[model samples]
Target: MADVQSLLDKGSNNGGCQFIGIWGMGGLGKTTFAKALFNKLRFTYEGSCFLTNVREKSKKHGLDALRKELVWSLLGDKESHIGNAIYPYTMSRLGRKKVFVVLDDVNDHEQIENLVGRHEFGSGSKILITTRDRQVFAGIKVVDIYVLEALNPNESFDLLSIKAFKNDYDDMKIRKLANELTQYADGNPLALKVLGSFLNGKNQEAWKSQLDKLQKLPCREVNDILRLSFEGLDEEEKNIVLHVACFFNYYYDAEDVKKLLDACGYSTEIGLTRLEDKALLDIDGGKICMHSLIKQMGKQIVREESLKYPTWCNIFWIFKKSSEILKKNMGSIEGMIMNLSEVEETRVIIKAFRSMPNLKFLRVYGNLNVQLRNKLNASGMMFLSRNLMLLDWVGCPLKTLPTTFKVENLVEINMRYSKLTKLWDGEQNLVNLSKINLSGSEDLIELPNFSKAIHLAEVDLICCRKLQNVHPSILSLHSLHCLLLIDCKALTSLTSNTHLKSLGKLSLAGCSGLSEFSVTSEKQLFLWVCDATINGELCSSSGHLSKINLVRLQRCEGVTSLHKLVDMRTLGSLDADYCNKLASNLCSKFDEMRALHFLRLTNCSELYEVPDNISLLASLRQLDLSGSNIETLPLSIKHLSSLRSLTLNGCKRLLSLPQLPPSISLLHVNDCLSLETLHLPLMTEDREGDEFSPEKFSLINCMKLDGQSIKAVEASVLLAINNNKAIYFWAKWNIREKELQSGSCIGLHSLS
Candidate 1:
């Protein structure tokens, strides 16, 4: 505690902006220290936020959700709408407010940028970052970087005694055993606690036996001490722990693990909880987050099962061992995950897979380079195991499945970006199949009859450029929930069946050859028809199908307008970027879209002026008009009370902009070479509502715009640029006379 307080004192004491980094190896209690400091300093700030398990949570739910959570935590606003670009909203809301924030377990620099960009927070704000890798702190100005050390012998003994015997150390025998255990722990607190608790209730003879084994094989490393905890787990719990370490720890979600284990007759609910209680795994934001040391210990246990017989282990993860086993034909493995994306290409015989008779789950991942280079000759081994259930091979370079392979018990097949023209030569009974994801299979030309796949729920064929025909039996599947045919350039037609009552989303974007479509179902929530040259009128013949929440029709060369959306009251997002042929006059009809929250018209080089009534979209949050030919914006834009982001990038011919609402926090006006006049609202106490300055302002490449126009807008912005020495603002700017023009003066859009 004294060490923590002493380090805190070394930070910037005047409440100026500062960043403190705490870095150390796994299990050194970096998170624990950060949490303690957060609790101690939280009350001193106007607002505070603590983001825990940032690395793990970013994988499961994505960084956008985390940004929303951060907004709610710091600003205490439950209804804050966070867009895809989250930094602007965070800066707009929290920039001027003194706050304390702690980002825990950050692994990537991109994560740091998206969460907390070049810190422009309030003067007294403090940001703390904690990570296992010291290199992650590079390029950031940190006031102090404290590396946590292992506990002392006495402290380790006390922690062990508390967890093991509830602090009751009066008995000499117990005290002696505890002291010996602490020494084996070697000042690592996690090892001491786990080992001490494993031998808590055992008799002295049992302790003696355990100690004898420990003496024979001394616990010299932290992972070795963690191995003892594994020894105490039952067979079922051990399997669960091993599975997590091998597979789930990397990317698999907890629900997927639960389903897989439950199918294997293991009580996954109880086993997972037991593992968590034993400190083998932790559940963060509903995902498995195992400590790095625990995962290492689990992998070590599997490798030790038979160092000479690695294939005898229940799971395989290491690329070297799996590759060696396959190359040397030394042994057969149970299940494996092979990712050769970042490695050099290597050719292997298909018989390598045939040797693994017990293989049930196999996942092969590759990059474009591997797909083009690696070869897997299957002429010698044409038969696949009948026990295979899940086969996911991304970037596979095969024309078809093995002739002898059967698909009776296959539950899922994901072969994205494969070079296959057909999945199979003949019809096969896919009785248990639930999903088929052949997305990005550019050369795929056909799909087998899915009539026998009664349980099939989804079929994705996105970007299958050569796929001209889809199986007619698809319309017969009543249980199908999603059918994604996005960018199937060669597909000319599709028939929508009314039996697909559960169909939720249908994407046909970029299918330039598609001219016919039939829609008979009404359950679709998302419809993306961008870049398609559809033959028929959209929703003109079909009765009003009104349940859609999103419609993307960008670059649909044949469609001139969204005249068919007269009844789509539920539409909230519309992205028509680069839709060259979209009629510009239809912008007047957008007033009917009162529920829209996001509207993007980027790169629509043909669209002219925006409709004056566009401000009728009262609930709109984001409005983008980048790369459009629009000449002027409606002055009524100030009436959009809910607008947060307004992008007018590349509006080369735009003459002027009207008074923008203070509700907007992000503005982009780059490359507007012809934009001569500007109007910025001045900040004053009389300004209507809570005013927020633009967190981000870009004016790059506007060659004809005068720099003095920006100076006259906000004088403080010049001071801010000079004070912070912002590197991003160093390009050429033509400075004009320093005089405030009459009505074109810049106002509250200052760079803070």
Candidate 2:
């Protein structure tokens, strides 16, 4: 506590704006110490606010909502600003007021920029940030930093005694037990507290028995405490933790795990939260994390089962014993993860899988160096269990799956880098299948019929270089949400008439051989950003696409027009940043999408002009026309009442811009070397439309601005900078006759 206070004083005692950072590993009491410091010093500042769960809340909601909550908490008001205006509003409201703020569990630097902006508050203000990853503060300016440490042996024992044996502290036997338990805890307070509570009411005999059981288990005290957390969990939660501990600890995403566990009839979200509460698991940076000790405990439990039945263990990690285990007909195995490269049983019996009747998950991966005849074969077991849910096999040598293999209950199949030309001989009734990945299967030529896969949500066939055709039945999936066929060079077309109403994302990038995108889904699909050869036409004219929020196309050749959007009304954003062949007048169709808020047409080298009536999109808030061939803004652009940000970077041909909109707050015009004129409207301090002025302005490398235009807009730039709006000016200009006479060229060119 004294160290923490001293660190805070090093930043706050000088009455200068300061930022302090606290970083350490998990279970090190970072949050506990920060909260204590917050309570101690919060009253000294004029206003204070502590933002909790910054990482989790930012994911569930966006940063904009968090910004609003911060503003409301600081100003004690009913309503504040919204959207891009929040930054300026926060800077204005907190500039002269001394403040104390603590942002807890922050994981991104952008969150800090959005919430705090800068340390420009009153002289006495101080901001504290706490996080588990020290790299979260890499680019931020912090005056002081502290790394919290774990407790010592005596400190650990005392903390445990208070929680476990509060009323009977003098008993000699219990004291000895406490000493022994602290050795296991190793200065971790969470483990000490949890273990102490578990032993609170037990008798000396019970304690002795528990200690004896621990001795039999090879794990030391920390693993035993983690095992206690596992013991408190229900059966479903236990399965979830064990699966994460064994296979999906840091590789698979949380959402993917949820999908797999959900297929296994477990309430995954609730179970994960319960495990986190018990300190057995943590979700950090959107990935699952578990301590090494906790994970070892889970593996130990499975090995104990191996001790009981060495041949039919529920988990198999020994590859040399495969032949003996299979020949003995051990059938209790539920999970198997094997690497074929290290196996010494080369000519094992072909009936191994048949003995394991309860297998649910199987993953086999490794480089098999043996010849075809020397490999351990499985021809005798023609059929797999119907209860199997996940099958991930790499470098499979068979030309097709076994003829009698049952796949009715399978939920996921990943055969990446396999040698199979086809999954099966024909379509099977795969009703429960949700995900299928066959990437890098160069010999795969076609897909099986998916009409019966009603639950299918995602399909990935990326880089299947030899894939030539897709089964038309895949187009009819009603529950499909994502479909990826990137780099399937030989694939030519999709079903022209089908309804994929639930599909939201479709990717066909690098499908150079494909010349058509003829699917016709309903109007319910919302977002589509894909690279497909459309033969110089946009979406199918006959199909009705709903109001999509975003559509991005890159490097798609022979795409000349978007006339298909003439009837759509709810298009929100359109991006064709590098479509070099696109040379049409897109503004002619812009009027049809009145709800469009963002439009990006950067680097479209052939785009020589924009329509004069482009300002018809009253809802446009951001317009990016960088790296294009346009020479000047359309006169009608002044009518964009809601436009707030206009980025025209690298517009080499642009010579001038019309009067910017009154709602504009950001203008980026860097690298416009041909620009010579810029027009600025007078700004006032009123709430009406005429009082609006940009808070952020950049003019780096705009070399050709005339001296007269620079003189004309210099006052507005100075006014905005004086108001603390952060205006920057960089212009290449020759000395005017009057300026040369006064010798003021150096002072007039640069503004900081």
lDDT of 2: 0.69
Q: Please provide, for model 1 over 275-368, each residue's C-alpha lDDT reduced to its tens digit, 9 standing for 90 to 100.
A: 7655566666778877645665675666565355655566654343444565444344545555555334343334446666666666777553
On residues 668-748, what C-alpha lDDT tens digit does candidate 2 reach at each position? Answer: 888988988876542223424323656566777777877656755565565554554444445444443232111312223
Off by over 4 Å in 2: 1-228, 231-236, 247-273, 282-313, 346-351, 370-381, 395-397, 520-532, 563-567, 580-583, 682-695, 729-752
Report the poorest 10 consecutive residues by lDDT, candidate 1: 724-733
Please give each candidate's TM-score. 0.57, 0.66
The all-Cα superposition gives candidate 2 an RMSD in Å to the true structure of 17.9
CA lDDT, every prediction? 0.68, 0.69
On a 0 to 1 TM-score scale, where does candidate 1 land against the true structure? 0.57
Q: In lDDT terms, which candidate is top?
A: 2
